[model samples]
Target: MARDDDTLVQLLTPDGERVDRAVGPDGVEYSVDLTDAEYRGFYRDLVTVRRLDAEATALQRQGELGIWASLLGQEAAQVGSGRALRPQDMVFPTYREHGVLYCRGIDPIMPLSLFRGVDQGAWDPIETRCGMYTIVIGAQTLHATGYAMGIAMDGKVGGDDGEAAIAYFGDGATSQGDVNEAFIWSAVYTAPVVFFCQNNQYAISEPIERQTRVPLYQRAAGFGFPGVRVDGNDVLASYAVTRHALDHARSGQGPTLIEAYTYRMGAHTTSDDPSRYRPPAEAEAWRSRDPIARLAAFLGRQQIADETFFAEVDEQARTEAVRLRERVLTMPDPAPDSIFDNVYPHGSPLVDGERERFNAYRKSFEGSAH
Candidate 1:
């Protein structure tokens, strides 16, 4: 898992040292200036998100959930970019963006309901400015691109008040057609969208090396846009780079690709076993450069927060996790007939016919174990 640091924008080292500004090999200088309180807030977010992810993983293991996608090591990448977003911005996320969803003011129970098979995520995308979790690979990029195109057509680009869109995907998504199509459309239409790719080094059991020979960010240049690589483990770097990219897009500069160099640190989902395909040594190497640990070190060294503060945050996170677990356990399942809901805006004859057939089929099995 050794990476070439020459092209990576890192504002905080693994040991907690801060770099005010650093120019990557791509000549992009990344920096961030935040108040002490804001720095502490970021730490709280990282810790809390990690705790929630762990709780969800445990829930899945205990048969409470169908599956859980743990965002163990990518806390900094998600929180940093998520916190960097303006209230006016829109976000389209892959299924694993629980941290970003949390940052978007979504309750943890919303996603839990989805995995629990209760109902689709119980949140309004318009109100939250975040889309529902997209389970299909790379499809959200197209949705985001289309949304950004609408923003552009509506004259919502260029100026401090302008809006933008951000699409989150994994490194494996870069090889998908929908993602590339998004890149092409966004670049051509000058849509105000940023493509945030968290290159977590593996696509399930497939290593990143098998996905592509060139760096992911570099692919943006081929589509006529700027690209940058950032230390995904460094919250400061992630925040700065994402903020800059968002601003560039809002200013009518079109698209940018951000490759967040990081690791999964857990299974792709609760169903997959990372240990089967990932080496223990590789996992150990990434563990040392953990996103949360590095941020905590910086906060402690700078005296922005102390052990007592960390303890309180951990306690708060635990309390929240407990509450979420209770909520998931108590959630009511949707009505059986609800499956046919939302198939069409008004009503579809085809869907109505299917619903009738399904109801008849269910009626036939009534009071029968067979």
Candidate 2:
């Protein structure tokens, strides 16, 4: 229900002006406090993440990657929210949250293992505080809720150092049973988890209108929790809203649903063509509100970053892209038997038996000369 005058919480306008948001009945303006260095750092991360996405797409086209999920227009949404999490907090992401993975301190090329027909994901969740990308639509929501329950059992909520969890999903997943169940479970337990939906306007070929009758954020009200929508294209808005929600979670508050109103600027994946479903004018309209460009506009207009700083960031992003490309190109192939190695924490006879059969099958081919 986007009327001409929408009420999506926005701090940085599409034209790069920083607008104020009132907090309570007192009319106090809610804002994010960041030093010049922090602002520059946010811009740097946005550039780096965008470069990473562009390079990954190009790599897929050049046959270095089997498929790439491009996070083109949603850089600000990912970067802003990702940075809002504390190191102690954990993250469960849908496959498209590559920018969040980057913010979580995982090596940018770790996802290459999955997309390149290698391992599912090659990093340790405990080490990175970021779970592997879940390919099944809304499945990660359930996993995140269960994990949050464990956090509650461990008594890790209600303090400055308390931990929280975040589940990242798209608009399409909102229609799934798993997502609804997650909502129920989290609400019942008052689990300290934030449901972050990057409503990029499309779930593959289907549009948002096909998913829900009302705004996505409003669905949380049915589950007995608070919900808010923020301008996904505005980095400052995304950051402020996420930081507040996460802070609330850590302070013993229940789940909060944040619907980031953004757009998917590219195809669903390397295999899909958005041109058939999405109109050119629709994509063009969002492009004028591009996240990265708007944040840069704010910086330039306020003199927060000089041309030299942007130039330096551009060079740094290129270096980062090159590093990821080189690493991905030379990534070693995993052993065929490695698949069964991590299938179980405790050994399972069924899995071992299957692995033995698979090994024998490969050995049968090794001795053939014909």
Candidate 3:
């Protein structure tokens, strides 16, 4: 079946500048006039996120981490949308959104601690305005929807210059029942939120076509909200679409859905072997359309940045990588009893019993060991 082409909104092409008369939403056209300072910030965000991801992957390979998820090619998608969010807007991210978490001022060490099996969450959700990384796939959608409902109830959606909530999920998660329910609730109640779906073509080993008969964005209409697809590799386009959707949500126009069409150029996680399921050619194809390189090319061609700037950014990335490696190596492992401490706010008798038993069992083989 032929899909609807008009549903996609792209302000910047990979080659730079707009082609095909691609317009953003009805009001407040998106800006491509990013000042040099803004461009430098974008460069820094991309470099640091990539470095953080690489460091995590290295830790997993070195047995410092139990597992890791690499967001190699999805940097622009995360950075663009992440930068668009206001300080007041909350973020609900899937596990691989380390880039977004970094942009939101959450420490990158949070992911490392979780992967090292030392902590459930190293960052405070309320303080960072970023919820815990939801590893259970699309379940965070409901949590985000509920949060948006509370925002609506509190009359926070339509004020403060169009502040709104945004939820981030992967392409595979679109099939989850919780995500669909979130859409239904958000649409029905007119929740002030945007569903930012990064359709990176594959959900682990499964491709997007296997999960949906139509484009993912089209699914939003069945739930009574408009949807638009943007070039996820184009940071400018991603920022434009998200800003527009968030503005719409903030204006009390109800929730909006944005499908960022991009590709994931790495394994699903460090534990998975992509060669077993994905063709090398497919990964190669997407690699040529690398999100970071395209942006660099655009900047260079437009004379917005030169080789010296890139060299400095690369150097900064190396420094961050070194720091991450050192931090991961030195992170203290949580005591066995730490797990029992946060299970219940008040307390749980069963947990207390288990803790005591475990302590006694450990002491049984102490200094007087056989």
Best by TM-score: 1
Q: Put down candidate 1 lDDT per residue, 185-273, tens digits, no spaces.
A: 99999999999999999988899999998888889999999999999999999999999999999999899999999999999999998
Candidate lDDT (C-alpha), each: 0.93, 0.88, 0.83
CA RMSD (A), model 1: 1.3
Model 2 misplacement above 4 A: 22-29, 367-370
Candidate 2 lDDT by residue in tens digits, 1-370: 2431255777888888888673421122347888989988889999999998899999999998899999999998999999999999999999999999999888888887789978888889998999989999999999999998888889999877898999999999999999999999999998999999999999999999887888888888899988888888888888888888888778778788989999999999999999999999999998999988898999999999989999999999999999989988898988999889978899899999999999999998985895
Q: Candidate 2: count the clashes.
A: 0
- Give each model's clash number: 0, 0, 0
Model 1 misplaced stretches (Cα beyond 4 Å): none
TM-score of each: 0.97, 0.95, 0.94
Over 1-370, each residue of candidate 3 has an lDDT whose tens digit, in order, gives: 1145455566655556444345533333455666877877887788889988988898899999999989988998999999989888889988999999999988788888998998997798888889988989899999989988888888786666555789999999998999999999999999988999998888888988799998888788799998878778877778878877887888788898888888778888997887887888888877776767777776787788899999999998899888888988998878977878888999999999999999998888899848
Q: Model 1 clash pairs?
A: none
lDDT of 1 at 181: 99
| lDDT score, candidate 1, position 248 | 92
Q: Which portions of model 3 miss their true places by more than 4 Å? A: 1-6, 17-21, 24-31, 367-370
